[model samples]
Target: MTSDTREPAAPTLQPRNTPARVSFWSAASGIGLIVAVVVTPMFWLPYGSHYTFALLMLGAVAVPAGHLGRRRGKRPDARDRGLALFGIVTGWLLILVSLLVFVVFTGTLAALGLLFGTLD
Candidate 1:
């Protein structure tokens, strides 16, 4: 039997998987770290602006991560979800705690100055 008109089978391409994990969550962590580092230096500006910028960057990372995390071949485990939640919560907590510490330190310094006659 001679097959002269049959088309060749196309090669199947495997989809990438690791990027789904690294791009979103990893990038988010980086952005969160940057925000934490920059907050103190730029604290004089409005807090809302800083928070909004951070949140926007987080959402940008999340969009790709969300899609990558839900692939047909692999399902996200409880541990992954837990880790993500923990990271987010920890970031906010760090910010809150740092702000509190700054407030307390400044307040104490101001009070001490007043008491000692430095700011009379």
Candidate 2:
């Protein structure tokens, strides 16, 4: 009679040159996203509403920022990960709400219906 249980294999870490390591490109992307979201609307061309700029820019920012958040540092700490992710996600949520408000104010949703459909 023999025991069937086996020990789990330990996770092997890769060498320093691992391709997945944090990179300048990823960090630059993260910084760009955050900066554009926070800064661009102020300098944006005159528009009908703040929501227009927010709608256009914030969602664009959140996706890649959140992606790069994980690999922001070669050895990112919990705070780095948390701040990056929270900033991205929160910014996105705000943008979505702002877009809804924009659709209501600008009648954009109604306009789309008329583009290819006959309006009585």
Candidate 3:
């Protein structure tokens, strides 16, 4: 066969309107973090409990997502990478925000308690 000189085919671009699919569990876990951020302060959960919850959510959801992405993409696509990163950051930021909220809420409560001459 005569040698064929071809530069090889370039990858085709996806349509601009094609939306990237999000992994269901990955998103659910992220939402779980958001909930923890809100609920911890509202319910007056101890910081340790909030931290524990965040850890469980990460282990149960985010780690599995990374594994699934690795299986699906071999080298994960931007969408997969973004989902994985968001999952991680969601858990971390939730913990951080929860701690901040907890401190502020407790401080305010303490100050108010002192003002009333009784600790609640």
Candidate 4:
């Protein structure tokens, strides 16, 4: 039997050249959702309703932004896909809830007016 003279080489770890980056549109979408939530209470303030609607419309931008963000996140070096998805969901929820509230308020007002014969 021949004696082994050479030692086996140790395993080596490869270093990453760059860190993954968070998608910008994803961050923007998340920020937009936060702003929308914060502005929701303005509906009760005088002349604030218009601003609230405008902000909500602005928040709707997140939907498209989130979509773009999600696509970006699919890349190997991009991140924050979950944040993008959250933005998309919250954006739709805010719009739907606002519409529901508006419809309910108008319906209730009409019912009250009709009951009191004030609608004519």
Candidate 5:
């Protein structure tokens, strides 16, 4: 009996040339959900809320910055990947921060609603 000792073929890794598709609606809904969670605190604040401007600034700075700074992975004249990575990280950070802020905001509102009679 002849014994075959051939090594198994290695799997090929397909090159990822296509950039991730970011839709306007998905982004918008994400922003909106986060905002709904966070913005409720403004209504309960004694004075005009300081958090309003913070949310606005987040949107103003993060959304466009994120969109404008996505990675162009396949371009011949692509800029440093570090910058793109930074942008992606920063974008995610902003999204997470928004989510956290919204959570606190909504919780505070729910507490207030329970205290009052508006929760129904």
Candidate 6:
């Protein structure tokens, strides 16, 4: 048999079992929802009928982010699906509440205007 002169081939590296990562959007959505819930009440305290448009803005952002987070969380490498769902639910709730507040405020203003004969 001829003498083997070639060096042995190096062993291939194997992939390690790494832990899955949390989705950033998911975390952001959740945190934002929480903050909106906590801070929005403070606004209500100052004026029960004024300065609540911020809730609409926050809900608008959180809803989309939560949807994206939920999609990402579906992947095997990402996590926090529950938090994403929570964000989505709370965001929608906030939007509903904000809309109701706006409607009431506008109606009250219109009624006052009519009463004072300002809307002729």
lDDT at 48 for candidate 2?
A: 37
- Per candidate, the number of residue pairs that clash is 0, 0, 0, 0, 2, 0
Using all chains and alpha carbons, the TM-scores for the candidates as numbered come to 0.37, 0.40, 0.40, 0.57, 0.40, 0.58
lDDT of each: 0.52, 0.52, 0.52, 0.59, 0.50, 0.62
Point out where model 2 deviates above 4 Å: 1-48, 73-79, 108-120
In angstroms, the error of model 2 at 103 is: 1.5
Q: Which stretches in model 5 have alpha-carbon errors above 4 Å?
A: 1-73, 116-120
Off by over 4 Å in 6: 1-50, 118-120
- With candidate 3 superimposed using the best TM-score fit, by how many Å does residue 19's alpha carbon deviate from the native? 22
TM-score of 6: 0.58
- Look at candidate 1 and tell me the lDDT of residue 14: 60
Model 1, 5-119: lDDT tens digits are: 9788897656444435544465456456556657665653456345545554554555455444444225433224433443444445444544664677678878998889864
Better of 1 and 6 by TM-score: 6
Give, for candidate 2, the lowest lDDT window spanning 10 residues: 17-26
TM-score, ranked from best to worst: 6, 4, 5, 3, 2, 1
Candidate 5 local lDDT, 9-47, one digit each (tens): 998665432222222323344466456655775553553
**lDDT score, candidate 4, position 77:** 62
The number of the candidate with the highest lDDT is 6
lDDT by residue (tens digit), candidate 4, 17-59:
1211222343354456446556775545464456446446745
Which regions in candidate 3 have their CA more than 4 angstroms from the true location? 1-79, 118-120
Residue 82's lDDT within candidate 6 is: 70
Q: Pick the candidate with the highest TM-score.
A: 6
For candidate 6, write residues 1-120 as lDDT tens digits.
Answer: 998799989986543212111223433544565465577776555765433566666567667777777777677656666766766776777678778878988898899989889646
lDDT of 2 by residue, 1-117 (tens): 898998999986533421212222333444564466467765433543653554546555654665565454346232245545555565565567567757776686577787757
Residue pairs clashing in model 3 are none
